[model samples]
Target: MALIDDTRAILGDLIAFPTVSRDSNLELIAYAADRLGAAGARVHIQTDETGHKANLVASLGPETGGGVVLSGHSDVVPVEDQDWSSDPFELREEKGQLFGRGTCDMKGFIAATMAMAPHLGDLDLSRPVHICLTHDEEVGCLGARRLVEEIAGWDEKPSLAIIGEPTEMRIVEGHKGCCEYTTVFTGLEGHGSRPELGVNAVEYAVRYVTRLMELREMLKGRAPAQSRFEPPWSTLQVGRLAGGVAHNVIPGHASVDWELRPVSDADHRFVCEAIAAYARDDLLPAMREISADADIVTHVIGEVSGLEPVDDNEARRIVSALTGANGADVVAFGTEAGLFQKLGMSVVVCGPGSIAQAHKPDEFIEISQLSACLDMLQGLAGKLSTAR
Candidate 1:
């Protein structure tokens, strides 16, 4: 079909930009804004603080309420160490798959949505169709959070939000919320022979990490019996730990990076409070006894709220109707869906490609998957056009 060809062409252009999360994505965002704008959509660009990156929100058809939003992140994970047979930034088609860095992790959905832009102007629609493209999603969904805040201030709120994360075209009803933290432990250094005169930061860091492991177990036990989630429990892990320069010298500084993926807000709060209580009541006393300067500090680095499946979710119903899928799923990885849900918009995570291919080397999306996505968007367009 012509639309499928357009989608592939757009996907190629998008893949060429290499919008890695660590680098600026202004080039890609500008390209998308221009394309969508040229298609007779009203485009609004939300630039980041440095103006090096942006989020694009474009609407077609009516400017009123109760429209559908198609959302996708523009950034891809880094390809620095991955073993790729072809240039990760260059799109290569082999057999029935289109290979590139962002093809599966997402720009495929973005491209498909953009390909449908021209048709939006022609559709005799009652409610508008909105495109929400954000940056920095690979890095803890920072862009989506900002976009959600911007959306919150809009005059006309959308009725539903479909985050085009790779779900193999399945309707994703829920996923876990991820919160990351870095805890720094500081102590007074002294010679190894005079250990009592110095506070050992490494030792205390180990103790704190041990406490985190205990919390992990506590979270595991908090899983609800009726939960549909795989593993069916909230999880915690200390991903990175670094401390101590040399064995002879008493180490004075240590840092540990940890994360919690909570199934519920209560579990999230419980985990945070448990860590704080342990730091305050147990760790601080021992450290202060040696030197007043010794201390522990924890900072939240990244966080994305979890998507809870609602029995009567509007977004889920809309997606199921469009895709003709009666059942929904829960994913282990995080996406921007939760943020939209928090903004009072019903949300579903459904898109082409398998997440198993996401963030891996030689990432590719099957051409058939892209075709399926285009068909789904066309179905949505038909629905919006007749909704009056």
Candidate 2:
């Protein structure tokens, strides 16, 4: 009950930071670092080049290899254009749930982890418990990429990572990768009467989209036998397209925003390479004929790797035993788990709250969820204290 009260207090302070992906999360990082430092943990802050955002990695217990990492992101999506019953940044308790922007999406897990830090520090542990809180995960797992790179260079690296991504405290072993992109097309604008004199940028952009759809279907055929993912294949969608001024005039520029959720590496490679070839060999050459200055360019917004499942998973076994879970599952959403997996760590996603409440108006997490997360962390502490 004391841990629950401390968790609630910490969650309120975390919600007040307003660390949106587009804005700085330095304040939140500082607060977490201070709290963990007070509890006798060795804390390090990894900041981005801009110094506006940072990742927090703290080590408790013995400074040794084969530690367990508790990870979560510090950033939340924007609150603009959404209707809320109360201020999105203010933590509001209603019934048995705590309402706020990051409460469920997930500062809740971070709070629970932080609340038990003192207890973890007091234990006679044989292994370390690492706290990894990151920034800009909503944008593309940007912060975790840097964090894992830092972890890789260390002499004492963790062997397991538990990504707290609001999975109702269930153990999730796999999820799809998210790749976002934007492509721009440029051409010569001329009178609409004679179409041959000018290249139509919109038409060529449409062709690029068509190529994506074709590849989307191709990905379907390449799906592995009895895949667990819903639809059982990688998928693509064009999010936005904007171009042209009027019906009679030829538009000189156009752009399309698109994304892909890849289930595997082969599918990701196939879609990316095919799209590049289509643009280079088919679209650009033809567009340049009408105007030598014509061009097509693609910008990478983000490329988050997918968490693959494996039977030889220490993190999964440990979490399953602690939670007394009989089964594991895969989710459709992306998380920072895959980036940690790239470092050869046994990664598992087990945390409090529900994904359904994330990034919406009046988002909330049940108090029971935080209490459950506290129990898991406590169990983890006991296990680490005994793993000697």
- Clashing pairs for model 1 are none
Candidate 2 residue 177 C-alpha distance from true site, Å? 1.0
Steric overlap count per candidate: 0, 0
On residues 1-388, what C-alpha lDDT tens digit does candidate 2 reach at each position? 5999999999999999999999999999999999999999999999899989999988898889998999999999999999999999999999999999999889999999999999998888888999999999999989999998889999988999999999999999999999999999998898899888999999999999999999988888988887899878998999999999989888899999999999998888999999999999999999998789999999999999999888899999999988888789999999999999999999999999999999999999999999889888988888888643
Q: What's the TM for model 2?
A: 0.96
- lDDT (10s digit) by residue, model 1, range 319-381: 788889989989899998889898878899999999999989999999999999999999888
- Candidate 1 structure lDDT: 0.91
How much does each candidate deviate from the true structure in C-alpha RMSD? 1.6, 1.6
Q: Which runs of model 2 end up more than 4 angstroms from their true locations?
A: 386-388
Candidate 2 contains a number of clashing pairs equal to: 0
| Alpha-carbon deviation at 188 in model 2, angstroms | 1.6
Best by lDDT: 2
